[model samples]
Target: MGSCKDEDRNEINCLFVHGPIIIGAGPSGLAVAACLQENGVPSLILERSDCIASLWQQKTYDRLKLHLPKQFCQLPFLNFPKNFPKYPTKHQFVSYMESYAKHFSIEPKFKQSVLGAEFDNLTGFWMVKTQDFQYFSRWLIVATGENAEPVIPEIHGIEKFQGPVMHTSVYKSGSEFQKQRVLVVGCGNSGMEVSLDLCRYNASPHMVVRNSVHILPREMFGVSTFSVAMALLKWLPLGLVDKFLLMVANFTLGNTDRLGLRRPKTGPIELKNATGKSPVLDVGALSQIKAGKIKVVEGVKEITKNGAKFMDGQEREFDSIILATGYKSNVPSWLKGENGLYAVGFTRRGLLGTSSDAVKIARDVADQWSMINKIFPDIDTKLLK
Candidate 1:
């Protein structure tokens, strides 16, 4: 609300936020800011990256698309363009994100990497320290979603590999690996899609299936599997819904076990609810696997000079390696929540959950804002600006 130099350090800049200070300018932060604006509550957004939705804009492959239907992925109080496909492309989704920020006037402080945020008991405010400024606010919102940072697991002798090895975050296209023997280490959605893309680019991709996973068709009976599951969940129980889904998957995609992909003991939806592991929605990858265009292999034991050694004692030579190990939240590393601090979008329920959290946080903050104004009528209104 106001800017002043820190008394102890005159060169350091400090600002007090009137409302909540939201971290991350991703979909989660934008949604929360828009909802707060709707409630007549202003917010300050701090982003480490220069643009909104940096993960989608900077870290995704060209072929990436929303795995679920548009409705499931959209933010609060806004709908995806009707012109866009059911599952919008990465570029299209990024464009929509930009439009959402513009429509809500949610301009965040870009490149403001937060060093740490702590609740100050003395002043009854949150002190957020960034690289250039110190921010104080009564409310703090951690909007950094689950995928704030990529998970890079250590592999034995990976540094000794003669070929280029990269994570999915830095991977863009399979054209770079054309005619090369590529080893994809992961069986998640990104891994599946990356392997398929490699096949399309005439690259030989061997996908490693390290663990049991649920593979479901993206669409079943001309309807989105996610939509069907949501509808079924209205009346049927989760266990029953999982059974129906598995039965249909078996009839449609055949047994994945024969292709080295084993089904997990826990049902798909139940497993997702328990652990945040999402079931892979096959997008032509299964067909390629069946046709021998994409080879499915076992877990990697170690990385060799040329390629990798599998846990099953098989050795293969690869020109490149792609790790689709996925991402996780970095909240624990920065903010320590207490007092007025809150966290949204870390529920593992995706965008739909984010929308819900945004609305709830806005309402709570609005109530507090109103009460503070009513009780402390003589307090400086400029301080609460």
Candidate 2:
């Protein structure tokens, strides 16, 4: 392998055609890259953003902390700095990701957006295509993650009334909405957190909650909820496990019944399905709703110039509307092949979605590649990195 040193930075050169190609530079992609590096694999990660973990930098709202504890959320070979808070804020998390990339020396090709990829059965490789470059790889890993595309709920006059309308993914801070009547649509973590942030900034915020959600503290009885989950999952069925979890959450954190929105008639009583699976447990936003800090309303049916009209015959006006709607997964769009391409992080696996999920995806990909590695001995373990 040929290495070039530019400004004391070790730049890796792509020497072989059969090396693995990993897409996306989020947690899952980065985790795979770090593991491959440790194994001396020469894999290349392609990221569209100018920096790694673009979603963490771009999409996360102000005052947002990891719903999961720090021990579970940190990626392999990289831990959050000790000086960091227990549950890292959005900025802190983004900073941790930057350090992770630098520590592993995972110098991803920045701004190299993958336009498309296709599997070539004849060549037994994936023909990877981007805006400026093209390559072929023996194995392709799609870790683009689930939040690449923002899910903007369809509402009448969304495009028509349009006064700086954008999804929660595009929202960076609440300082912009000072003294404005802000209508926060959705009651998920993002919705509640953003609404709370806006309230602190003196923005008259109202959360347009469509339904009820169960809230759980990140930690319970001085133990991480993540640890609690691992122990429980080993013995119980998913349905039974979900029931146990919800029961604990509702009893401890209070229910959302008094707010007009009723809990859905579902098995697990989960949040939205972003990454193939449901959110672990809801963090209580009902407190904010009941305290008159954030007004919870029914769903939005339409929108006018002043503001949005709700499904329950309510017309609420706002200076700005932050759509805490959700996100969409685009991992399938990266694979290039005629055969079955394995996708892991695009959906929920074993309950927890984005919370410490990259590690799980990395392990799954590792298992799949183990078989591939046996057949193709020429492919260096470094390529897996």
Candidate 3:
């Protein structure tokens, strides 16, 4: 296998090929590569960006941090630094990904935007084509996480609004909106965190929570809520776990009825298990909402030149709009093939890279390939005439 350095960020050079081809160069890709190497299976990573973990380095908000504790989010063969906080910041996590790649001797081909992949009947291999070159591999893994594409809702009159509308990808800090009236759309984890960040900067921010959602504290009475969850999930049914969690939340945070916050009729675990929409694990947003630092509003009915019209017949003005709406994933678009393709980042099951999923994936793929390589080796990757 050959190595593609990061200096060629702008140029798409055909420098390397052979072995497994992993896409995205994010945590999932790096983790799979690392584990495959451990199993004596060489792989090459093709990343569209110059650097690894483009989503973390470029897309995430400035003040953003991991919602889960650091211990649960570790990749295979590497652990977070001991000094990292309970919930590591985006910067810290990005640094960890870089170190993981380096430590595993994983050098990904940079600036290789995979146009599409197709199984070449002549070559008997999956040919991954970037802008500059095509590389063949027996296995193709799509590790681009869920946020690969931002899902911007079609707001009525959104085009007519005369404010700086931006997605959470480019949103860095709230200091830029100091004293400005801002409307934050959506109520996911990012939305809640961004609203609180604006409050810290004294921005008059209003959040639009369209539906009921689960809100959890990072800790309950000094015990990590995640730790509690792992303990409960082992013994109870998902519905029972949800009830127990709702009880704990009510006990700790009190009913949020007065704050215009409504708990979903369904429990968080049930919602996650059923719909794949993750629960918002609260860090410090609720206290601020209760203190009148951030105002909560109903969903947007429409948009005006200056502000959004709410479903409750209320219209308010704001200087800017920050969309914290989440992301979408269509793995087949990037890693198309006749067969033998795997997706590792964001699945319907949330983030596979955040847990032991990648370890299991690498192990399974290696086991499967050991048999393949023994018999008709290069049967899939045979060079086309």
Candidate 4:
């Protein structure tokens, strides 16, 4: 209901005087909005893309499924369909996100590409400028998430290689690479799964796993490993939980090092909690590897006309390379000033932490908005007059 043209005609755009303004309409953003709404605080969500969760709809490969089970991935104040599987497919999760938005009745303004934002000391509110509009609010929440941008690491001779190179974000299935020897780089979840997808299609996939990583079965003894580890993490010390995970990994995956699946110097849970690096939640990748369908190699030293040089001083030819390198968190980029701005879903705790933080922030806003107004006193100046 606001226009940049009208704001330009004057000095300020006051048409949007909602409670809090949230950028990005993904699950995290929607969580923040829903939580605030429950507290009777309305929030305006500005999404740059056409639909919510555009990343999942556009970027995720077809063979992808949630590394965690569905019970562990539900948004706050919402639940996945009862009929949904434990570990839902990527498409199923996407559809669940859509239904979550609907159930919460959260309406996010689409295509509102934010150029930048600034806090006005005089008004004690945020002025978020998009390409075509300016939305003002008492608070600004940035929940664009860690994977808002895809990161492709620089490999030597990568540019000179004369074959198709793309990120796993652009990959859908292995059918396109059929009968072609494809190299899947990085040992992250995407890398493992993408290589498996290629194997299923008989694409002859080879993986470049540079370092040791802790891999676990998605389910052990008919129970999700995540459920057990998370329960342990909640009750036990971090160190104890970390060790428990290591033991579980050892028993289940069993000497991944022998298969070139080396363990990182950092323990699995320790690595994930300390930094945001994701560990593999193996569905069928390991079985495919053990079956000799997916071959593993070391890091890429360089690229050639029709091949890649490995760290072991061996060269292997490939038709293409898919970098599943992963993503980086970046909500801070939107803020020209940090005052009155909050970011969630960047803590690397994945969906659970993201959803929890949204609820926490929403409750904080509901409890303290009046205090913030009194301290700043600008709330009176722009009290929806």
Question: Relative to the true structure, how large is the alpha-carbon lDDT of every model?
Answer: 0.93, 0.69, 0.81, 0.84
- The parts of candidate 1 lying over 4 Å away from their true place are 1-10, 377-385
- Greater TM-score among 1 and 3 belongs to 1
Q: For every model shown, what is its TM-score relative to the native structure?
A: 0.96, 0.82, 0.91, 0.92
Please give, for residues 136-217, the per-residue lDDT of candidate 2 as tens digits.
6766778787678988888888765656676788787789988888888877768877877787788888887776554555
By summed lDDT, the worst window of 10 consecutive residues in model 4 runs over: 2-11
Question: What TM-score would candidate 3 get against the native?
Answer: 0.91
RMSD of each: 1.9, 6.3, 4.2, 2.7
Q: Model 3, 343: alpha-carbon shift in Å?
A: 1.1
lDDT of 4 by residue, 200-266 (tens): 8889889999877889877767888888887777789888887877787789778898999988878
Angstrom error at residue 4, model 1:
7.0
Point out where model 3 deviates above 4 Å.
1-16, 330-332, 348-355, 376-385
How high is the lDDT of residue 231 in model 1? 99
Q: Top lDDT: which candidate number? A: 1
lDDT by residue for model 1 (320-380), tens: 9999999988988887759998888988899889999999999999999889878985453
